[model samples]
Target: MNGPRHRIFSPITRAGRASGQRGAAVFVVMLVVTLLTGLGIFAVRSASLSTMASGFNRQLTQTHYVADYAVLAMVGELGLNAQVHSTNMTSGGSTQCVGFAELVAADKTPSCAQYGYGELNALAQTYSSQELLQPPTGTYPATVVPGSLGASPLEGDMRIEVTDWHPAWPILPGNDATKGQLGYAMVTVSAIGLVRPNPTGMAAGTWDTASATAAGVESSRAHVVLGPILMSN
Candidate 1:
């Protein structure tokens, strides 16, 4: 009987081994690609949210400024009144005015000739003169009239109110009435402002009319109230 013959097996070939390794490498590359894609998507979402928050904050800030400006304008008008002693007017006795047209007209200046500030001021002056001359019959002894302050875009709506007028607390003795004592007046004004989106894709949403309509980007009602004695004594 012949001795058991041993068949010699060749060692694994380098080319074959390399081919198998290549397959595994491809799988690893695919997995990395998938992970990177997922991260990219998450980054995009986070950025979008941040942008939206920033836009909303800006809008709110603008609204507050608009309201404040309106109240200040009304205060200026009240201050211009010669008959009312700046210091001694009672809160409840102060007047209130509302009207979008009137407000827009009054806001105009010579530099804003196209906006018609002159006409608006004339109208307001006339109205104020009349109101002061006639005075009110009520016990509170104040008038609430409607007048325009300046010219605003047709889309803008504005309203103003003066209130909280009262004789100064801790009235000083020996104060002359002719000069008028210090008095307080409160003013509230509301306005809406529109914002347009960036055209170059720096911000979300487009500047088109459709985007504006969808976002409801119009300004909200702005209100400001002045407290304490405003009129002079």
Candidate 2:
């Protein structure tokens, strides 16, 4: 019995060690799978957010262009000495024409197209400036243009107004009647321009409505000087 019995290896101990090792390996694999899943979800969410931001930016730019065009068109109509009827005038004085006209002696009236330019009104003279800034109330009914706004499926409608108007030069010389006949007077006017989104891509006035423009609407208020048009007798 003597010479120290050599320690014998226990199968149970060896089996326990192997089982613990297998448990650790399984836990590591599960952790790796969970991490991969988390990464995939994060990537997908980032992509979705990016797409949404891109879309919004595109829409904003479109609105800006539409508004700019509205301003240009309005200028073309008023700045180039376009003929206007008194009944057709919407904003200015009800009886003064925009173009040059002689003051008729019989009627004691300036011989204008129809009426004088509407008084130079303040900003947002036509629509509520507050409501024009946000969604829901910001959008307005599409105005009919004589022709297309340009391009297909992308054309939009517009809203424009004259925010300020007045004579820019050649002031009447202390009511001098003689000067009126010999001298000429110039006039300048201000205007505002806006545009709305048309999802249906239909022609102006055909599908444009207040309710339809309640969303995705954009507005622009511009103080544009039409010019010193020659008004003379």
Candidate 3:
């Protein structure tokens, strides 16, 4: 029997195998971490978008309410006097009454005639003499003054504008020289209400000059045809 055979060992090969196993484990962990991070980012973005949409909806609703109030105010004023061309009243009397003639004429003249029978005719003639003069007062019965539907808590960015007031006449055929004309004094009123950008980063584009004019004309025409108060956000 010879001396006990010494078992041969390969240290380098064993160490190399162990190192490969460790690298594989590290790669798996890194992949899992990357996937989790991507999922977290997607969730955050979704939440932000949802919040923005909700805020936008709320602002839109508030703007619509304000617009509706303005339309109602205009209609009430018109109901007081269908023939009255224009009248404006502000809250707490802070603003003076603005009438159609004042808006159109460069120089507005005050009436000197007292309220009476013959004086009424004289006043009508005086007003008729001026191309921009409005219809005589008392032609439209006085009604309750409208209150301010200010944009306060909802959104501080709101505006109202009265665009046009005119008569609604039936279109006459060019060929018909003896056509009977049907006419009615149509009071066209237009207003705009806006809601400021919400905290959630949802904001609508501001109405530019052209857009405002177009919207005013469209709204006036719609209300004239419908004969009802119109509102929009």
Candidate 4:
């Protein structure tokens, strides 16, 4: 057998090879850290946006219910006073008249000066001012059914202001019908709702005094003009 041959070594030493491998590993680790950081930021931003949207949506929903409730309650309350009267004539005949809120004629209406809305709105405020007391004032006047509790996260109010009135109808012969006029009234209602972030004091978290102001709040409002209800004598 011929003499064993020795292999020549390259210029790069083992230490150099190990150092190169270590550098590559370091680069990979840095890349992974950067990617994780980006993902974390994205997650935080998405969560924040979602929270804001949720808050806004909650306010909108609450306001919608508030408006709907206000309208329905107003109508229901006025409906209770509705009346149907039949006047009998001397000739043994009769006429029917419905008494809802008072009726308003075209000529004698005035603007809603109380709420600062001018004549631009279809229904104008008339009749002398009466004290329409609302219990527990808030962003608006809401009639709370008996024993219902309110929460702080959402605050709201509803109010109905009567603006006009009309006399009852369908008179019998020689009957002074206007003396016992059924209710014919026009009204305007307002419903307002508000929501705000939980206060720092409300829960356990690291909170700064300045952060309390930064906490966001949202609000929603609805208004409607309601009309002529039949009132009883």
Identify the candidate with maximal TM-score: 2
Estimate, for each residue in 118-217, the C-alpha lDDT of model 1 and write its tens digit: 3324545676743211221322214433222112111212234333333433434554444353433333333333333322322222235644552323
lDDT of 4 at 110: 32
User: 1-233, model 2: which lDDT tens digit per residue?
Assistant: 56977977799999999999999999999999999999999999999999989866765665676566555545545544432321123233433433323333245443222211122122234534331122222223454322233321344445444322433344444544543433323223222223345455444435556525532445544443332333343
Residue-level lDDT tens digits of model 4 in 78-177? 3443331111111122121111113223332232212111211112123223212112223322542321113332223333332223342434346544
Local accuracy of candidate 3 as per-residue lDDT tens digits, 118-220: 2323433564653111222221125323222222222223223333443334432342233233233343445454444222222234444533332211111
What TM-score does candidate 2 get on C-alpha atoms? 0.49
User: Which parts of model 4 are misplaced by more than 4 Å?
Assistant: 1-7, 10-12, 76-109, 113-152, 159-233
* Model 3 misplacement above 4 A: 1-9, 81-84, 87-153, 170-184, 197-233
Q: lDDT (CA) for every model shown?
A: 0.41, 0.44, 0.40, 0.39
TM-score-superior candidate, 1 or 4: 4
Give the 10-residue window scoring lowest on summed lDDT in candidate 4: 113-122
